[model samples]
Target chain A: MRQSSSTTDEKEIRETVAIILQNFSPLKENLIPILQSVQSAVGYIPQPAMKQVASFLAVPAGEVFGVATFYNQFRLIPPGKHPVKVCLGTACHVKGGNIILEEWKRRLGIDEGGVTQDREFSLDRVACVGCCALAPVVLVEEEVFGTMSPSAVEGILLRIRIEKERRSGCGGNEE
Target chain B: MKTITLTIDEKTVEATEGEMLLWVALDNDIYIPNLCALKARPLPDANCRLCWVDIEGRSAPVTACNEPVYNGMVVKTGTERVVRLQQTALELILSTHPVDCGRCGKNKRCELQKIARHLRTKLKQKRLRDISKRLPIDSSHSLFSYDPNKCVLCGRCIWVCKEEQKVGTLHFAYRGFAMVVTAFGGAPLGEADCTMCGRCVEVCPVGSLIFKNAEK
Candidate 1:
């Protein structure tokens, strides 16, 4: 049953990928655009989709993967429902951005580019969010939390939980 | 492919006009220290910054790898200014590279060692403070082992894997000091779609990648 379901998932990916790649000619210059399109369409660049792009472009799978991993803009892992981006810019790094990142990692029990077991949160780092005045900044979904500290991570999570509870009418959200 | 005559270290040599000066020099038994000049990569990465040579009519020394051979071109490989520049570059590379040559797999065969010997500099260069990345050794691949700590970021392995072999299994990821040669999605060599071709192992200039049989 698992194998059959996986094959279907693969088939779906193949179709979606084919559609996304149809507009893109097999030029090396179009590689980035194709990847971006597929990412926006599929939420993340799945390994299979990456292979399809590689084959379409006639580049090695590893080179494609290399380019994918080289840039922070691209994400290989699927983002969780609540995606969190920690800014580690020069100002933030000085103001303990790493500490806040560590706190998040400890609380979530997952490293960067990882999702929680419940898929509620995902963690990733950005070079600079251009919010140097608000050093040590974090973005949780659409909301930006600046001057972030290690101690404030729980409060952020609590606020998220409260927001969830309010959205789900208290009893709708399960333990 | 016009054959051109150029003077490197007072020695007249003939090479293809568009051929890189570093290769020309090496071909004619004129040794210019280089770490990143793969014959396969036409455009030099110039990341090593070690192959400095003084070309006449140019005030500042230029890297030999990036300089193309031209007719009547004169190059001084070992000027006082060139030596200083090369030494500083080697010092910076050594700063990040773990220099325990005694226990290293590529001890005698290492390019860093050869360059240092040719340049007449100490391997344990004391000018720069050490900032080695002590990443874990990936011994997962049955054929070879990879120690990121020992890598010099030469891009030789990456070029061989991606360009030459068309495997693209290994490549540079991240930026600044955090940059690393990682597999697709940062997977291990064993788990990645690597064909166990061992080209990456073969092209690595340092002890970063070594055949399992060659490991101590």
Candidate 2:
């Protein structure tokens, strides 16, 4: 069982890297764009993407993987369904956004960049969204909601839950 | 075989195959302001919202970056509404960013500084002091230091780090106010597995990431 699992993991990793290389061939000029696309497609750039990117570009896999793992931007794991980003940009921080973020941490029971236990939410902090007028803003799934609070977050969560239940119930009903 | 004519600032201009409405305006010397766009970079980010233009047929302002040129795409380059939107976007960016221009190395050279000077914004806008989170400046290499406090998070650094150098050492960490670009384990830039290629510092629009030599 252990051998099978290990092989499957390796296979999956290879496949992911293969997909990255296939989509972006001739690895030098398009190296960065290819990596960006891979990360966009799969939350973070996986090891497979690095290996394939390295081999396709004719660079060492270790070199490619080392670069991938070096930067702060690439993520290894699949990002959650909803990427809840809190604005920690300097302006937001000055305006008590940190306190609001703390409230979110307490409510969500996860630190920054942490996925919820159920994996429904992934919380991240952004440098700045450039929306300083809407200081203390939180972007949920790419939609910006300004002047956020813990209570407001709860309301947002409730809406998400209700939407999920509705989706599940409708699916069950159809079944 | 399709030709679309457009009017910019009341002057008639012609458009050819696959031209964006923005290119037409720029070609005609009608400058509609934008922040995230450089003629050098591929296209508009649409995140800055500085180049919102009012097209005749479009109900809402279409970003000049993404909007393709259609036949008779009448674009108003200098309208009060467009100016207001640009000002608002600028103000928002300013509110979160520090106003310590005197001390910043990019004092005269920053694109943001240029915009502020052009807009004649007094720097009187209420800035959020607490929003200025101090990120560990990666001084590992003798070449540069990345101060997260001044970063605008335009994703340009990310673009340069991964895209140009292919050294993925910098990334956006945490979400919201806690968000910053850092190496693994939040290590300083020097300690992180960085090649110190200086590409990320080169492309950053603001003073957040700077080359040590370039520091004023």
Candidate 3:
């Protein structure tokens, strides 16, 4: 059953690539946009997807892979439902950003750049969020939490839990 | 190409007009420490930032790898300021690179060792914190092995693989200090679609990529 499902996924990726490639003229310059469109359609760039991009762009597969890796914007794996980005820029670093990062790691049970087993949260260390005045910033999805401390992180978790309970109309240990 | 004359280290040399100063200096038997500038590359990568030189009219030192030479241009490769900047660049590279010359196959022949000796600086950087990642070594390939921690990210290997060999097996992934040469999706070299041309091994400047036969 798993093997058959994987084959179906492969077929889906190929069809997605074909649809995206129709918008591009197979020029080397269009590779990035093609990859971007592919990612938007499929959530992440799978290994087989890279081969499809290579063949469409008429570039080597390795070159496409190299380009994908060189840029920080690309991700090979699927992002979590909630991305937890901890700012580690120069200003945030001086403001004890690592301590906040550690607190998040402990609370979430995951290290930097890892998604939780449940696929709800993923942690990443960002270079900067461009708001230096709000040093030691943490972005939970689209919302930014600034001037963060360990206690503040706990409060944020509690809020998330409360919000979840309100949405589900129930609260339990499973959450 | 038109021929132009330039003075480097009190020695006059004739070089192609609009040629990069780094190659002209090296071709004329004048040494300027560099790790990223490749003769085969049409444009200089200048990622290493170790080829500092002072031209007569410039206020500060400039990297010789990209600077164009003109007729009668006076260049100084070993000024006090030039050496200091070069030393700082080498130190920054060493801060993230492991310094184990004794255990490395490229020990004596390593460009890092040669640059350090030239600059009279220690391989173990003193100022910067060691932010080196302990990435797993890929010994999967039968002919060569890769230790990402030892890589300097010179782009020579990548350029040689992608352009010269047209293999495109090796590539850089990530950003900031986390950037590293990797196979697609961080696959092991043996498992990747590598042709085993061994050109990447030949272009590696440090102990990052070593031939299996050369291992002790």
Candidate 4:
């Protein structure tokens, strides 16, 4: 069942890429927007999609990857169901943002720019979210937890897991 | 092309009207400490803010590589303000770069070393905290080796690989502090579509990329 589902996901990604490519002329200038659209359409920039974009635009795959990686807006990995981001801007960094990030990595068992084993969470450190007033901020999905501490990371993860379990009809417990 | 006359350091120089100010000054024997500006490839990435020059009627110093030459423009290349900015920029670049100069292959010929000597900035890199990427050396390529620890993030190699060589084998990966130049999918440089052109090695300002045969 898992193998079949993954294959279906791959098919869907290809179809989505084909649809996105049709909208733009095969020009170098369109590479950025194409990447942005692909990311918007499918959460993140997948490796296969980058290859397709490169071939479609007649550029090398490495060049496409280079442009994608140069910009902070792009993400190569498939983000998990709940994306976790820690702000490391000047304000946050001064307020112990690194400690908070370390705590999250410890709990998730993943380094920066990594996805959890269960595919439930992905962690990243952003330069800034323009919320300097809320230093040491952590964003789980769309919700922002401001003035966060290392200890707060666990509570946030637990709440997210419990909510996910309840929504999946598992009653927040697994035997 | 129309020829324009500009005064750089009180010396009049003639250049094409639309030529980059940095090249105009350089062609006329004027020196501007720059790393990313390449003469072969004219596109200036302007990431290195070292080529700042004081232009009359301009409030602040501007990067000469990005600014176009105009007739009767009075420019000062070595003003105190310009030198200070260049020194600061060089210091910032050195903070992240490894200071193992004696052990580096490009010891005497390194452009960064030349610029540092020209500016007379301290070689110890104590102004800012040192931040090293600590990436493992990539010696997989039969012809050359790629060392990210020594890279200054100058986009010259990327420009040569993409524009001049048209190979596009090397590219900038990640962003900001975690940024690096790597092959597609972080594959070994030898395994990538690289043609062993050596243009990247030639354009590299530091010892980040070097020929295997020259490795000491």
Winning candidate number (DockQ): 4
Candidate 2, A61-110: lDDT as tens digits: 54455456555566766667778888989989988788878887887899
Candidate 1 — which pairs collide?
A: A62-B168
Cα lDDT of model 4 overall?
0.90
Which candidate leads the pack in lDDT?
4
Q: Candidate 4, residues A1-175: lDDT per residue as tens digits?
A: 9999988988899899999999999999999999999999998888889999999999889888888888877888888778999999999999999999999999999998899988889999999888999998988888999999988888998897777767786453331
Ranked by TM-score from best down, the candidates are 3, 1, 4, 2
| Tens digit per residue, CA lDDT, model 2, B133-174 | 655555666778878778776767665666567776666655
TM-score of chain B of 1: 0.97
**lDDT (tens digit, per residue) of candidate 3 on A77-109:** 766777889999999999999999999999999
Clashing pairs in 3: none
**What is candidate 3's CAPRI-style docking category based on DockQ?**
medium
Q: DockQ for every model, please.
A: 0.49, 0.05, 0.55, 0.62
What is the full ranking by lDDT, best candidate first?
4, 3, 1, 2
Q: Model 2 scores what on Cα lDDT?
A: 0.72
What C-alpha lDDT values do all the predictions have? 0.88, 0.72, 0.88, 0.90
lDDT of 3 at B186: 79
Q: How would you encode candidate 4's per-residue C-alpha lDDT over B108-163 as one tens digit per residue?
A: 88988888888888767787999988999999999889999889988898899989
Query: Whose DockQ is higher: candidate 1's or candidate 3's?
Result: 3
In CAPRI terms, model 4 is classed as medium
Compute the DockQ of candidate 1.
0.49
